[model samples]
Structure formats: C-alpha cells, structure tokens
Target: MIRVLVVEFTRPDAAAVALGRFLRDEGVEVVHAGPVDTAEQILRTAEQEDPDAVVVLGAEPPSLPGFRVFTTAAEAAEWASGGRSHTADAPSDRAR
Candidate 1:
C-alpha cells in the first residue's frame, strides 16, 4: 500500500483532516507528522517515517528533495493517488 506523510506547520484544520480521510478511503496509509516549525524539522520527520511521498500543507514549500507542496487537500490527495498529471510545478528531485 502507498504510504504518505502529511506535514503541517500549525494545528491541522478541516482540510488537513479531510485529506487524511480521503487518503485512507483510497487505500493509502496516511501518517500525520503533526506541526513542524522548519524545513529541517519536516525533513527529519520524513526521514523517520520514510513515506512514499510527503504532502505539505499551510507551511511554505520547503527545499527538501522529492517533496510536494499543495495549496489544498484535494490537490494533494489527487497527486498522492496518481490521478493528477505531472507538471513543471509538480514534485521533483530538485530542491527549491
């Protein structure tokens, strides 16, 4: 099963909760990393969890390699499920 790590900078809002449920419904293992303050903190969580992908919400998009930033929970869910086509703005190995 696909595993995804969801990271946020602040308390999870309705959208974040909804995304967790959506990912669960799609058969993806959702792991919540809770609130983190910096990009390094997020990277640490990712390393610990080692999820297939990382979904960042609210926080500024970090420079971590292979991380995806989404403005909305729906968009993140779609990307996680392979429903969204890759684009220049999509997740890449390049760091920002």
Candidate 2:
C-alpha cells in the first residue's frame, strides 16, 4: 500500500482530518504528524515516517529534497490517487 505522511503545522482542522479519512478510503496508509513548530521538525517527521509522499497543510512548504509537498488536502488526495506526478514541480505551493 502507498504510504502518505500528512503534516499539519497547527491543530488539524476539518480539512486535514477529512484528508486522512479520504486517503484511508483509497487504501493508502496515512501517517498524521503535527502541530509541529518548524520546517526542521516537519522534515524529521517525514524522515521518521518515510512515506512515499508528504502532504503539508497550513504552513510554508518546507524545501525538503525528494519530497513533493501538497498544500491542500484535495491536491494531496489527487496526487495519491495517481492523478498527478511529483515531476510537475511548478507552482509547488497549492492554496490552503
């Protein structure tokens, strides 16, 4: 199964929670990490989870090499569903 790490910089809002559920329903393993303070913390969590992809919400996107950061739950879900590719790196930040 595809493993996705969902990182929230603040308390998870409805959208974040719903994203987790959506990923679960898609048969993807969702690892939720958050309310963390810094980009470093986010990177550490990503490293620990070692997910195939990382979904970041409510914060500036960390410049972590090799990890594609999706700023919205819908974008993340679409990517996770094979509807998007990490190679399309332009416009890296999705509107929250």
Each prediction's TM-score against the native?
0.73, 0.78
- What is the per-residue lDDT of model 1 for residues 1-96, given as tens digits with 9 covering 90 to 100? 566788876555556678888999888778887777888888888878766677778846677785555656777777767744343364433322
Which parts of model 1 have CA positions greater than 4 angstroms off?
A: 68-71, 83-96
Cα displacement (Å) at residue 35, model 1: 1.3
lDDT of each candidate versus the true structure: 0.71, 0.76
- Give the clashing pairs for model 1: none
Cα lDDT over the full model 2: 0.76
**Evaluated with TM-score, which candidate comes out highest?**
2
Cα lDDT of candidate 1 equals 0.71
Model 2 per-residue lDDT tens digits across residues 1-96: 567888887555567788999999888789988567788888888878767788888866778787867788988888777745443454323311
Provide the clashing-pair count of each candidate structure: 0, 0
